[model samples]
Target: MIYCCNDHVELALDVIVDEYETFPVLRKLKEEEKMSTACEYCRKEAEYMVEN
Candidate 1:
């Protein structure tokens, strides 16, 4: 799942890996080399990063 921002806006949630490529923003995420992830509920930094 990918959050639109740290403010708890979700771009995708509970998605399969195959579905990732369908999201243009997720693709942009890879090109930009950004792997920022956070909790949608608590708004805290995630325990670990999720690489694209």
Candidate 2:
């Protein structure tokens, strides 16, 4: 998923390497560079939430 609020946008979820290319979340991740970074960051956050 992706969250956009005018000033900035962020990745709301993580995606696999292969899923990156066709992930629904990445479709609106904002920038091309930020896309990957967002995915990684969101992935960690997601894991933390799930683990707990």
Candidate 3:
């Protein structure tokens, strides 16, 4: 799974599709869940989880 901020969500989606060759699942993070996660493409707090 890739953790991403709003700005990099599209990039994360592209990565999942390119690497897995399937549609990705995108989930918004809960407020508590956002505490320790960071975006894969940047240092911002992650707002979503992207996976296939």
TM-score each candidate.
0.23, 0.19, 0.97
Instruction: Name the best candidate (by TM-score).
Output: 3
Residue-level lDDT of model 3, residues 1-52, one tens digit each, is 9999999999999999999999999999999989999998887999999999
Give Cα distance to truth, residue 23, candidate 2, Å.
Answer: 8.1
Please list the residue runs of candidate 1 whose C-alpha ends up more than 4 Å from where it truly belongs after superposition: 1-18, 21-37
Give the runs in model 2 whose Cα sits over 4 Å from its true position.
Answer: 10-19, 23-52
Number of the candidate with higher TM-score, 1 or 3: 3
Candidate 2: tens digits of C-alpha lDDT, residues 1-52:
3333222322333333234554343332334534444223333212211010
Write candidate 1's Cα lDDT for 10-38 as tens digits.
32332423576553333223423344555
Task: Give the per-residue Cα lDDT of candidate 1 at 14.
Answer: 27
Per-residue lDDT, model 3, residue 46, is: 99
Residue pairs clashing in model 1 are: none
